[model samples]
Structure formats: structure tokens, C-alpha cells
Target: MENKKALVFGSVLLSGILTFSLYGIGSSIASDDSKHEHDREYEYRDKGTNYSTKSVGTNKLYMEECGSCHMAYPAQLLPTQSWQKVMLGLEDHFGENAELDAESHNSIESYLVQSAARRKGESRKLLRNLGNKTPLRITELPYFIYEHDEIPCRFITGNDKVSSLSQCSACHQNAEKGRFDEDDVVIPGIGRWDD
Candidate 1:
């Protein structure tokens, strides 16, 4: 009977030690995850201007419906106000009937606003020349114009494959992935464009 009591006590003590050890390890892992999330560029901001490195389309419906027409364009390409305006005027979206039900519209608008570009880095350059202007077209951005300035009108407007600069995927291989590195650009009919 004494031996049995001793064995039971020993087992309880071992169990307690194992539980504490596992708890410590879990806490350490949790701390590391918190640090990683903080360092991530796409951390959600409740109310502030900040750029996000994360790819767009956190909402499936937004990507499927909006992308059905165009590249769906990265939400990071515009500011929160610009996204709001676009959502408000979806019925007349660039002469296209992009009408959406109120629920879907609100959901898409929320996603766009949340994913909108920060007023920093390249995003700042995009809005540089414009003051208090919310351009409906992403191509209207000064940075976009500057980037495409070297390419003659013949290549863009003339090329049947690329009707407009807005057709980002025409030249950018990874436009859908939001990677617009100039090195990857290859005009459809014109072929590779190192410039």
C-alpha cells in the first residue's frame, strides 16, 4: 500500500513537470509569432496611412467579380479615398456596367479600403503630382505615366494585344501576382522590352 502511494505521488509530480515544460514552450512560440506579425508589412492598421506588401484579393468575391472585367488591379494602387470613390461609382465603371448588389459592393469596398495603398514609398510617388485629386483610372497616376513614358504610343495604343496601359498583364508577366518588375515586361506583339 505504501509503495502504491509513493508511485502515485511520483507520477503526479512527473505529469506536472511535463505540463509546465510544454506550457513554457508554447508561450515561447507564441511570442515569436507575435513578433513576426508585427514586423510584417501588411499588418492591418485600424486608422493610419501605411503601405502593405501583401497581395490583394483577401476577399474571394471581390477578386472573382471585379477581376472578371480587368486585372482587378491591386487595391494598393489607390488610396482609401480613391477606393471609396470607385466603389461608389461602380455603376458607371469606365463605361462598363459594373453594378453590384449592396452587400457585395460593401464587402468589396471594405476589402479595397482595407487594402488601399499607404501614403509612403512608391505609393507616395504615385500620388505625388496629384493634389486632392482622386483619379478614377490607375493609368492616370503620374508614376504610372512616368514609368510608361519611354514606351511610344505606337506600342500601347497601336498594338492590338494591348489596347491600353491599364492592361498591365500585357507587358507585365506577373501583374496578377502584383509583381511589376520592369525586367519581366514583354509587350505582346513587340516582344521583350528591357527599357
Candidate 2:
């Protein structure tokens, strides 16, 4: 009788464990389905494209030093080598005195190079295409120009608020967050860009 009781108890415990495991598997599948559905619904509602995915820099020194003058563009916009060159040429940063002290300079330099663009995925595939080049200006990069090919100079260089094409946030509402989706674009004088 004692052995029979032990067997019954073991069976009940195993049954419970199996049930919980199955439930967890089912829940994960349901969650993935929900995300797909949400994406489909968003595309149907939104008139523009998505940012897909982009990594934003989180270094405090990089923000304070680089951003103090111009918009602290995302470090991933450039490759590791490009960042190295930029940090090496601060005194003449695009024809400006962006020189920083050793400590601050080293910190910002490390951050930019470490957080530079990767070489894969939709967000970073462009980095791989930039073979044989280490462009200092993000605007001059072939991939960046291709991405902004639809927009004319009038909407960018011609606009007072956006003095040049380098001014990303001038139109990208979530540029700081690394999102440059087509739907989020809204030029100051003009409206949504669809091309």
C-alpha cells in the first residue's frame, strides 16, 4: 500500500510539470504571433516605412562633447576606422575648432569607435558596402546618399531650419532614438516625404 501511494504521488507531479511546460511553449508562440499581427496592422495604417533597426550611442562623454556643437549623431552612422580618423582630427572638425582635452578626447574617441556601425543586418548592411572608404562625413557616405536620394537640395540645404543635409533631426522626429523611418520624416517647411 505504501509503494502504491508513492507511485500515485510521482505520477501527479510529473503530470503537473508537463502541463506547465506545454503552457509555456504555447504562450511563447502566441506572443510571437501577436507581434507579427501588430507589425502588419502598423504597416496598413502608416503611410511611410519603418526605421527597421538602428543602434544609438549611450556614452555620456560622447554626448556632452560631440553634441555640444552639432547634433550628437549616432556613432553607428560611421564605421570604426572612420570614427578613429574623426577623433584624430578634432582641431579641424569640418573646418571648426572641436579640440578637446586629453581626458575628454580619449573618452569620446573610445566611445565613438566602440559604438561604431556593425557589418550585418538591414540597419548595418550599408557599413559592409562601404568597402575601400573611410568617410569622415556621414552625408558623404554612399549609403547615406542613397538613403536620402529622394530628397532634393531645396528641402534640405535650401531650408533655413535645416542648413545642410547633415541636420538629421531637422526632419526625422526620432533621429535621436536612431529611427529614420520614412513615416517619421517631416520637413520643417514641408510635410511627410514619401519618395
Estimate the TM-score of every prediction.
0.68, 0.70
Candidate 1 residue 105 C-alpha distance from true site, Å = 0.7
| Tens digit of per-residue lDDT, candidate 2, span 1-195 | 999999999999999999999999999999998876555311111111322122122266677778888888877678889989998998998899999999888777776776667674333745646887989998878878888888888999899988788889999887876666677889999998887
Model 2 stretches with alpha carbons more than 4 Å out: 1-58
- What's every prediction's RMSD, in angstroms? 9.1, 9.7
Q: Which ten residues in a row have the lowest lDDT in candidate 2?
A: 41-50
State the local distance difference test value for candidate 2: 0.75
lDDT of 1 by residue, 1-195 (tens): 999999999999999999999999999999998986555433223232342323233356777989898887877788788899888888888788899988788778888887777776445556767778888788887777887899988899999999888889888887786667666689987888875
* Candidate 2 positional error at 194, Å: 1.2
